[model samples]
Target chain A: MGLAKRIIPCLDVDNGRVVKGVQFVDIRDAGDPVEIAKRYDQQGADELTFLDITATHDNRDTIVHVVEAVASQVFIPLTVGGGIRQLADIRRMLNAGADKVGINSAAISNPEFVREAAEKFGSQCIVVAIDAKRVSDQDEADKWEIFTHGGRKPTGIDAVEWAKKMVTYGGGEILLTSMDRDGTKSGFDLALTRAVSQAVNVPVIASGGVGELQDLTDGVKLGEADAVLAASIFHFGEHTVGEAKQQMARQGIEVRL
Target chain B: MRHVAVIDYGMGNLRSVSKALETVSESAEIHITSDPKHILDADHIVFPGVGAMRDCVSELRRLGLDDVIREASQTKPFLGICLGMQALLSYSEENNGVTALDIVPGQVRHFDTQRERSGNDFKVPHMGWNEVRQNISHPLWQKIDDASRFYFVHSFYVDPTDAGVIAGTSRYQHEFSAALSQENVFAVQFHPEKSQSAGLQLLKNFLNWDGQS
Candidate 1:
């Protein structure tokens, strides 16, 4: 393994503008995905992940064009997720200059889809994006379960165990997001990250709940995640990638500074 | 007019490379042309790629840009990025067979998984930012310090046969050649355009480089 711990900036693109509506709803214009992606790349971001929040409803061509436009400007590795369900979608994204394709709902519906896509495009190209939310139970045995449809529906599946299964099913990497921590400006769920990182053999990118620079460091050092991803912090000019990396280095974490 | 012809064989992110060059040069002309004449006529040439090594080499040969590149490297400044750098080597271990390029002496081999395994479960493709330790002094490293960070995204690396040509080295799981220079021919496995400040400095250094006549 030669890859370093990536510091990725995620973008939720809705109609070509980066938007952050509550729980992925009533999305308003945040900014252009291309402009935001270029800004992150310019700030020394390791990689960029673009989630087409409305791709499923808009169709494949729209996403492909957006990806093409983004790829034309940015040179770093770009991973496109959301509404990538079929082989054709994967191929289209790849052809449009996406280095990796992330699947979430499709993999949940069909576990074998991971293996099938990995077999077709190689494991390096497939990324499994897991959206999980913590559930409380009176039985005291309740745990976090996987959520689908933009974290709208619960699959009643244990996220930790499901992550392990995802890797076994040929997921090259895991992008774990905590629905509870998302957009909270509190911090990342270190426990959830550690559990998923321990369960998967491939690289695990800890997503959701990156309030400050220390959260990123804790996510990498304490959570043992291969990468740390944040959205609002970066999009809202809270912190640049270089600033976060400098903080990580100060905390005795090995980063490319 | 000082023009920089960026060889675009339909395999690279040339726009970023061109943008980086434009930032550094006062009169940098970025021409994404496959024509051999444009490559031969340019003041400098930058070969940029992010796709398969074999595909790029084959495309270069198909376009008869192989001879053009070979001729251009003799007098003009030539820099290869990522897969373009791999194509500058003698051969690559991709596509289940050895496709020879004969640009450099050594063969480009896939990263040794057995030898370069990290304890924390590192990923392949080596995507992201990493530091490059300067091994030899060259015009490219004019203002760059030791262990300068650079962005890399590749599965293969160059093994220069001549030690004198190696300019900088980086460690992933093990030490590997990150930047190489042999006369006017320079290559880097990392993408300087994507590397931000450090990368911009490198591009500026290259633009101001007075080594190649």
Candidate 2:
């Protein structure tokens, strides 16, 4: 009746190469971004997200080349993240063929930057990625706080309220990641996902902890996420994007097959 | 080699559009230009953009492509996408009120965003893939199945005064015009370059299309 729920396979790219694990991607020359991107597109991935994990500033420009190569061939939406702090950085990524550029620490450091970016580029291309973990110790803690530096630093900003503010500042979408369950292989923080999703009118992309196929459906049906993103499962060849769609379809969650 | 001009008015991304055209076009030279001469000299015209309509129209007028677009739509295989499609309307509700190219009698309005009575969570900007039902048969739809899902990421939808020009419709809050056609022009709200197989086919059809009904 409406838009289909999207499945995005995120590739952590460092200096122009996708790296999840050394042994996971040996089949097709492992780290080649173009090859991995092409394979995902062929498997019917709705979109592709390249999280630039490169450390140095000079090496950061490498992601732009990676985005350009993949975007030239793959005809789906491409979003690039990591080290996007200024307007020039956003412009560089967009000009290099990225459909959207994600803002993480920069967005938290200066909230006005979100408004400026939205006013300049339009909110459609601005995505604010939030890393959050539960603050309360009680079972299924209801209170969560924002974390920066990949969940190492806590900002004490309430996750739900921050999501609303980011959207108000003209962020088109929110990439909410549950730091508590990121590598646990358990599932998305459904409680955290629902709280933020209900508080905001924009689309929420659930990230961080997806171990299997059912977790994808749970994020949509239970967590109320507009899209689900994962890296390891798809990167290791445990499941194809096609298979994920079929699984969600079986669960009666609307997906593009 | 056929020359195709992608009108760039300093708004959104034209890189993907040109790249996609280059990928599908057979011996056709794709040129991304804002100049009037390049656009006027081209055999095919592809107008594409994103962002606000006020800026889109202002920039089009600033670059003087408004007249060029109007002129090209009459005698060439012209295609418009996203903000480019909205710019063809008479006016848009964005930025208070902004007048458009007036090629098609229509008004672009922001999504009502009125939560459906059935309790469906319909969001604005309507970002994602949605099914587009073909309202009329057109050459640009060649090799593409009807009601196929296409990538869309816009907050406003077009309402043409003349129903005949509406080539396609898609339901978001309610059914809205997703594609429009007039004589030699075809425009869409969705991004064909980003719609994968279905989108690629639409672009391929446009490249091979002869300016005929």
Q: Write the per-residue lDDT of candidate 2 for residues A190-234, one digit (tens) a residue.
A: 989988888877889999899999999999999999999998888
Q: How does candidate 1 fare on TM-score?
A: 0.79
TM-score of each: 0.79, 0.98
Clashing residue pairs in candidate 1 are none
CAPRI quality level assigned to candidate 1 from its DockQ score: acceptable
Top candidate on TM-score is: 2
- Residue A126, candidate 2: Cα error in Å is 0.5
Evaluated at residue A133, the lDDT of candidate 2 is 90
Q: How well is each residue in B1-213 modelled by candidate 2, as lDDT tens digits?
A: 799999988888899999999999988999999999999999999999999988888888888888999999988999999998999999999999998889999899898666752344567779999999998889999888999999999999999999999999998878999999998899999999999999999999999999786
Model 1 off-target regions past 4 Å? Answer: A1-4, A21-44, A55-79, A84-103, A106-127, A132-146, A153-173, A184-186, A195-202, A234-243, B114-118, B208-213
Residue pairs with colliding backbones in model 2 are: none
